[model samples]
Target: MRNTETIPAELSTLAACQEELVSITQCAEAGISKHAVLRLVRAGAWVRITRGVYDTNPVPVRDRICADYHDHVRRRAAWIGLLAYPDGAATGGCALALLGVGGLPSELAPEVSRPTWMDAGVRPGTVLRRYGTFPVVQRHGRDVAELVHALAQGLLTLPRDHAVAAICDALREDRICLADLGRIRSLIRGRRGVVAVRAWLELVPGRDASPSETFTRLSLIDHGVPPDGQQIVFRLGGTFLGRVDFAWILPDGRYVVLEVDGREFHSGNGMLADDATRQNGLVGTDRVIVLRFPAPRDSADGDIGGQVAERLHPLGWVPGGSIGPVVHLD
Candidate 1:
C-alpha cells in the first residue's frame, strides 16, 4: 500500500502556493493528505507558519525576515488568503510597490484585495479588503490587481499625507496617467475611505515633477493660497532662469518662487551650487521673492505649509487672496 506520509512537498501540486507556502486543505486537494504534510515537516522540508499555513522550508530564512518580521508574516498571511481565493490578489501598498504599479515603498502593513468577500478577519500586520472593480490576474506568479485599484487602495489605507505622497509617487512614475487618476476618483466614489483621497485629488495641482512638489503644492492650497503656475519656466531677457516647482504671480506684478528642496534632488554641493546660481538669476531689483523650504521625506511630519504661511503672512497672504507680496526667503 502506498503511504501518503512518504509523499514529498516538492512533488505536491495543489499544495503549491506562490511563495512556497500552502495550507493543509490545499495539500489535501493536491493528493497530499495531512499525513503527507506531517511527513514533509518531519523531513524539515516544510514548517508550520500559522494554524493552517505551512512553508515549504522547515527553516526558511531570507534577508527580509530579519530586518522586519512583520513583513514576513505579512507575506505569509497574503498567501493564506490566496489559498482560499485564488482569483484574488495582493493589494494596497505592499503589492503595488512590489509589482511596480506606482506607490511608495510598502513600509506599511501588508494588504490584499479580493474581488469577492473574504472569510478571514484582519490578520496581524495584514489588511484585507474586498474592494474596487478590477480584474485580478496572476502577475509574477502572484495575484495582482489593476494599477488604479491598487493606487486607490493605497490612498484609502495610508495616512492622509502618506496617501498623497503615494498617489504623487505613482504619478511621477507615470504608472497611472492623469486621466486614469480621474477615473480612479470616479471608480472609488462613494466607497468607504474615499473622502480624504477625493479631497486630495481636487487639491493637487497639475504638472508636479516629484512627490515633494505635489506635497508642497497641496500644502499651499490647503493653507488657502493656491499657487498660480506649477513647473513654470522663467526667462529674464533671454537669460533662462530655473523653472520653479511652485510659483505665484504676486499682486504687485512680481513673482514668488517656491523651490521645494527634496534631499534626493537638492542635496550635495553640485546641486547646492546649481540651486544658488538659479536663485541668483531669479533675484535682484525685480520683485521676485524666493522661498526655499527643505521638503520632508514624509509629508506627514513636514510643517512646510505652516512655514510657508508664516513666511508669506508678513507679506499679506491671507486665506482667500489672489496674490500676496513676495514671500520672504529668510
Candidate 2:
C-alpha cells in the first residue's frame, strides 16, 4: 500500500470528485510520474479503468459478487465516460441514473454527448452521441443533461414500458412534476420516436411502487383490462387490510385485488409471513377476490392480463365497453 503522507492533494481532491478516479494528466499535474503510477497499479493499490483513468479504491471481490454489482458497474462506467471526455456531458439513461432516477432497464450503456463537430472516434466502453446546445447541469459530480432533456433523450431509446416506468420513477421521486412532462414532449416533438414516446409518457400516473408494478400495470392496459385503481388500501371497520398493487372494481361492488409478486420484495420468510397476514385480512372483508401473479418480465408475459380478463368477463366486464381495444404498446 502507498503511504497516505505521500498522497498528493491535487490527486486526492480530483479523485474525490470522480468516484475515486483520476486521469494520468491529473496525476502528472500532481507531480506523480508515469512510473510511479504504473507501480501503484502493479502493487494492487489502484486499478486502471481505461487507458489513462485509474480508480484509487479498487472494487473488492465481495462487491463484484453482490446483488448491486450491475448498478455499481453502471455508475463507474458513467464516471469513466465523464473522465475520458471532460467536455462531454453524461446523457440519456446514463444521465438519468446519475440523477437518481429509477425504473431504468437493468442493462444500460455509459453514454456521453457533445456538439456534432466534436465527434470522438469509436470508444469501446461508452456510447457517444452528437448533439448541439442542450441544457446541462452538474449531477453526481459530473456534467449531465438537465432533467427534462435527459427524459426526452432517454424515452427515445427505451422500450415503451421502460420509458413509462422511467417517467413514473421520475415523478414519484419528485425529480419532475406533471407540468414538466409537456416540456419533455416539446423536446421530442420532431424526433423519430415521438409518436410512441408521447403515448408512453401518458402512461405514467406515478403511483406504482416498483418497476415490476409498472410492467404489470402496462401489461394489463395493453390487453384492454387496465386496473381501475392501484396502491388501493383495503380496510374493514378501520383495521387496515393492506395496500394492494392493483385493483379492479367489479359491477357488483366486489373488488379484485391483483398482487404482482416480485422476487426482490417477495422473497424470504419475513415478507412471506407479512404477505400471508395481509391476504388473510383482505379475505376477511368478504368483498375482495385476491389474485396473485408473478410480475411480468416482458411484454410477452400475458398470463396476468388473460386471467384478469377471464375473471372480469364473468362479472360484467365487456370487451369493448368503456375500455377500447388493446392499444398494443410494443
Candidate 3:
C-alpha cells in the first residue's frame, strides 16, 4: 500500500487525485510497480490533460486552463519567429480572452480558436485576427494594459472612428437613454483612445435636442439660463398664437418667448415670411416680449449666454450669475 499523506496539500488539491502522484512515486520507493498509476488513468478516475499533467475525476480541466497552455505555446513560437505573422496583429478585451489573454469567457469552450496576435507570439485562430493596417492604434492606459495591443490591432483593421460611431449611432437610434451612455463612459473613462468614444457620444444628440439644432436647450440651462418650458404653445384670449421653444411668464402677467431659430424653422422665403407674420401678430398683442436668437450656431458660441442675458434683462428676466459653458439639467 502507498502512503498518500506524503503529498503536499496544495499539490493534492491541485491534482485532486484519490491516489496521489506522490503516492505512485512512494509505491516505487517502496519497491512497488508504477502500474498502479497507469491503472488509475485507464479506469477513467484520472485524466492526462497534457504530458505529465494529470487531474483527478473530481477536478475538471476547464477551458481557460487549456487556453493558457495554448498561449504559452504561441508565445514560445513567436519568440523564435517560427510563425510568419503580420505586424501590429494583437488581441485585446474579450477577443484577448479568446486568445488566452486572461482566459476565455466562462461559458465558451476553449476548442473554438480564433485568430489573435500579441507581440507576434499569439497563436493563430484564437479569435484575434490580423487585418493588415486599417485599424488605428492608440495608447491604451493602465486599466487595460494587457488588452491595449489587441484593441489597437482590432481598431486598425476597421475604419477610424467609423466603427465606434456606427455603434453609438445604433445605440442612439434604439433610443438607449443617456444613463446607459453614462455607465459606459464611466467604464472606459480613463482608457486610451477613449476620445473616439466621447466624440461618438457628442454626435448622438439627446432627446432634449431639437432636430437641426446643434445646441440643446438643456445645454443652455447649464450656462446659468433658468429652466424654460420646451415646445410651449403660446396663446392669447384662448386662441393659439404659436409654438415657442422656450417661454417665461413674469409676475406682472407679461410673457417673454425665446425664439430659437434653426435652419429647419427659417430656411426658405416662404417660412421666413410666415415667421415674420407670426412675429407681427404677437407684437400686435402688446402683452408679450419676443427675443429672437437667429441661427443655431449663435447659441453654441462662447458669448451666447451674455448675449442672451443682455436681451432678457430689459424684459424683467434677471441673471442668476455668471453662466459658464456648461449645461445644467434637472
Candidate 4:
C-alpha cells in the first residue's frame, strides 16, 4: 500500500519540522513513530529519497518523467546536509547549481560532504565527498557551500572550461564577489584543487554573464588581444547611457564595443526596442564603434572572441601580456 492524499493527524503536528526533509532518527525525535512515516508514505505525503532520507514534497508518480521532477530530486541532496551531516553541507558542482552559477547544461548526480564514517551506503543518486573543509553555513535559508569552497570543489570536478565558466558566471550574477575569491585563494592555499583553479582565475574576468560569455572572454585572452572591460557601462554626466558585452579603449581615446550573440538570451519585441534605444543613444552622442559577433556553430568554426580581437587590431586596440594560450576546442 502507498500514501494517498494527506498527512496523518498524529504526524500533522510535526508539519513545520519536515519542510526541508526528514530522517527516521529525526522522526523519532519528533515523537513520530515509524508507523506514521509509513502512513505518510502511503498517503503520498512523502517520498523516500535514500535509505533514511525522506522528501516532504513528493513528486507525483505520473509526473516523474518531467523536467521539474529531475530538478526536485537533485535538490533533495540538500536535506542530507540538514539531517545526516549537520556539520557538512552541499559542495562541489551540486552547491554551484544551488547558488545559480554552475553553468552545467544538464543535471548531475548530487554531491555532499560528510565524514567517512557516515556511511550512507548505496545511495544511488548521491555522491559523498570526504575531502576538503566543509560544514558550510546556510546562505539563503538552505545549507550552501561557501563561494571559495564551492569553487575549489567545483574546479576539482569540472573540466577547466566549465570550471572557469562557473567562476565567471557566479561573479557576473553577483552570486559571489571578487574579494571572496581572494579569501578562497587564501583559505584553499594548500588544498589539492587550489593551484589549477588559482592559475585559471587569474585570467578570468568576472564581467562575463554566462558560461558562453566566459568562453568568449577566455578566447579573446588566448588570442592575445584581451578587452579593457567586459559588460561595460556608459554614463553621460548624470544620465545612464548603456552597457555592452565587451569594450576596448583605443590609444586615441575612442571607445569600441563588442557584443557576442550567444543564443542564450533572446529579447522579445519590448526588450529589443529598449536595447535599440540604449545603443542608439550611445552611438549617436558618443560616436562609439559597436561590433556584434554571432556564436560559432561548432568547435571547427574557430573562437568568436578571437575573431573579434583580430577586427580590433586595425582599430588601434593592442593585445596585452604573453600568457600561455587557452585550450581552444576549435
Against the reference, the lDDT scores of all candidates come to: 0.64, 0.75, 0.41, 0.63
Angstrom error of the Cα, residue 309, model 3: value is 0.6
How big is the positional error of residue 179 in model 4, measured in Å on the Cα after superposition? 4.7
TM-score of each: 0.68, 0.80, 0.39, 0.63
Name the top lDDT candidate.
2
**Residues 280-315 of candidate 2: C-alpha lDDT, one tens digit per residue:** 888777778999988676544656777888888788
For model 1, the superposed segments whose C-alpha errors exceed 4 Å read 1-87, 101-106, 115-123, 195-197, 318-330
Of 2 and 3, the candidate ranking higher by TM-score: 2
Better of 1 and 2 by TM-score: 2
TM-score winner, 1 or 3 = 1
For model 1 the local lDDT of residue 172 reads 71
Q: Per-residue lDDT for 262 in model 3?
A: 68
For residue 303, model 1's alpha carbon misses the true position, in angstroms, by 1.1
Q: Which stretches of candidate 3 lie over 4 Å from their true place?
A: 1-174, 190-219, 298-302, 318-330
Residue-wise C-alpha lDDT for candidate 1, range 1-330, written one tens digit per residue: 223254455545434334567767667766778877777777666776555567765554444345445444444545655554455577766565545432253344546666666576544434568774575556546677666777677777766665676677677776777787777788778888676568876644366677667667667766766676667777665667777787766455667678988756788999999999988878863668898877655443377777767767677653433332223332
The lowest-lDDT stretch of 10 consecutive residues in candidate 4 is 321-330
Q: Which pairs clash (backbone N, Cα, C closer than 3 Å) in model 2? A: none
lDDT over C-alpha atoms for residue 4 of model 1:
25
